[model samples]
Target: MKPIRIVCGTRESRQDFSTKTALGRSLLIHEAANPVDLMLFAENKQGLSSIYNRAIDEAKEDPAILVFVHDDVHLCDFSWSERLREAVETFDVIGLAGNTRRLAGQPAWAFVDDRFTWDEKRYLSGIVGHGSSFPCNVSNFGPVPQACKLLDGLFLAADSERLWEANVRFDEQFEFHFYDMDFCRSAELGGLSMGTWPLSVVHESGGAFGTPMWRESYRRYQAKYAEGGEPTPQETSVQKQTPVHQFHNPDLLKLMPTNAKRVVEIGCSSGALAREYKKLNPDVHYIGIEIDPSYAQLAREHCDRVLDMNIETVSAQLLAEDLAADCWVFGDVLEHLYDPWQLLQKIREASAPGSCVVACIPNAQHWSVQARLSVGDFRYEDSGLFDRTHIRWFTLVTMLELFTQAGLTVEAGVPRVFDEPQRERFLPAIHAMAAAAGRDPEMAVQDALPLQYVFRAVVS
Candidate 1:
């Protein structure tokens, strides 16, 4: 039998769960017949979406088992590696603690006293710790392992491949608080089984429920699954018949490779480009990623598949693993990213080595921008390069570096030209700034150029 490969995912904190805590103590001494990878997310204003999405992407790199645990959790049992290996054999989803019966609008622990479950035999188990730990002061829901409708978030283990097959994940919208229950519901609805297992562990803090934000999240959760008090696969799906919008995307479309067999577009708003491309070659496969449910529903008219997922929180690896495209397109999309360079890295890592990226990125080096900044007038605009929504500002040099740093080589650069009249409108300010900064007027004009950049990229 192949050795079990595991990836332990966590939102890391100051506490040393990896080396100093109760779980860390057991991890240090356990010898298991398996390989494990650790993926820790830095909790710098990030949420569970980043961690869970990242973990799913890691599974693409290596088809392994996924074990998500809290940084505050300390596993105190020995031979944990071996025990986990044995326990996960029969369950698609396994947890250290879970509730057998989940009530509508009730939290996971609503039936804790009677619905508690632990281990394969449906026996009850638990432990407590200081600073709000349980069992020492509290108690296990009961003393038997039982099948459960929902599992606690603290210690969740699942086969990565099985999860991919089931097509369930930690919903990005849930972010931090309600993700555990949300995931449990998603898994159950997808026909995956949930079970509990024996483990000696200590959680440092009890949950904080009933906060204002918590209540808000709770309302959204309830609303999301309002169909018969539970959403069905068909009801929740976003693909539906939609009227085509008249959106055009010629700049990025022209850069597409001549023989492109498959194309995937990130930030594809209702598949405008896909619609046009399908008219040319109906046989070519096209896919899109749109965050808006309504937009994604309309995208089905143009794309073979539309994934309704936010680019900021979804993993590029996870998307690439499924699309396997000949070319990946990003039209006026990079500037909107939280970390464009990091996204570039993931794209390269996940896609086939020779696959290319075609992009249309705004030029911060445009003379109009320079002319405005020269007068100390950097004001947000409704749209264009200075669009208020643009989170990233990249000049020519930095824009070129995007491809290089992502381990991609630029095949060609195509400038999205602006008419001379536009440049002339800001020409006077350009010279004025040049004189103030003691630079040559011609050099200033040349330095501040390019309305936008459209490039064709391939893996280096």
Candidate 2:
């Protein structure tokens, strides 16, 4: 590891003067022993190309890790060098700040390297530039795993050698916006990994320009990424499909007939999904049965009818007589059951002939999860495929078999997209566990199984 180099890109405009002052104050307060260099470019100073050119030139003679900081950010941590060095060693790209909301024009911290491939997107951690440790812990911040994408240009560190080798410098095109995206895209293309660590730094939003200019910059960014040829059509398509709701399969609703007269949802916590079905097809009367009283109350609030009884203890005959549903929904509920097979049997006995059974289950065999487990990292949490409450895990084959054994047939099934950071984090580990259990990680990874499975079956 070499001495960390800090570069601040500033403009000569009046707006930039404040940013320069803030950076100057941060340097003096932190008393950084290493020589910190500052570069001020005009507001229209030929975009970020000039800044990168100067940085490359500075590092050309003596190569070192370059830590780029924006004017609005302040360095709270004195030992940022050490933590940044560690992150740079582990991840190809390291981001310093975390944002609660996704800022326009800024890249979201998504996608991390799992050795084999990148995992889900994530958020950076810490105060933007306040003097906290490089791996500083801030409240409400989660794991900034080395596999996530770099978010924001507030603060970041990267190896000079690797960056130059990949020719992945920030793109100066479009003046200001999309520089981060261009750089990240180039890094991904160049086979470099990216992530954020628990580095704390404070950042004042829109330091360089006022809100108006910031909005303009974001507009340009959106236009470039949206219309520009930089992000390939496939990349754009993938990005378009990257919304949060895209993770759930809308087709799962298709499992139920449009004119389904009666429907039952098992383990309907909150009845959110059941309510959605009811809204979509109002003609289909919906009934939700929940074991938890608290959640049952929530379901009752949202759903038409709620059964506040545990599926395991309830009598099949009584449940069947209570509401003869044409369809049964097991959306993300089976895995949490103490005995999924027993519940399935009960449902089978209760269901009418040709009644549709829809189920969703998370694949325990995603690739990223496999990589984590292969490296000996298995921490149990409250939820996910390895949720502490989960007594059973299922892959595609086993899930299908479970349904088939219960006298049901699969009609349509597809992997749902998993684009969220939290869910993506567990994927590698799940896949690893599945592989160790001699299961196919690829099939398990496919259909983005809701860390629980979603299945649609017909009761024979």
Candidate 2, residues 1-460: lDDT per residue as tens digits?
4656767666557464543555555666765553554445546356665586578667867788887767656666677566777788798777754332222233333222112122222333433333323443333345554354345566667878888775666656535554665566456435566676776566555334334654465555555433221332222222111111213346567666777887877767766676567677877667777655456567775566665444554445444755467887776767766577876777788777888788777777555445557788877665665555555777767898888887778877766655666656666666675599897776555634444445677877
Error of 1 at 351 (Å): 1.6
- Each model's total of backbone clashes: 13, 55
- Where model 2 places Cα greater than 4 Å from the true spot, the runs are 1-251, 419-453
RMSD of 1: 16.1
Q: Candidate 2, which ten residues in sequence have the lowest lDDT sum?
A: 237-246
lDDT per prediction? 0.67, 0.60
| Local lDDT at 425 for model 1 | 75
Per-residue alpha-carbon lDDT of candidate 1 for residues 1-460, written as tens digits (9 for 90 to 100): 3234433334445356555444444455553532355565543355775677677776766776778776666656665666677677867787876765444344343332112222332333333343423345434655435566667777788878788877878888887777888888767544577777776667776776767877677777765643123322222332322233658568777778757788888877778888887777778878787655567667777787766554544344444655568888988878876678977777788777778999988889788787777789898766777776677988778988988998898988887776656677787778777789997877667657778888989976
Task: For residue 252, give model 2's deviation from the true position in Å.
Answer: 3.3
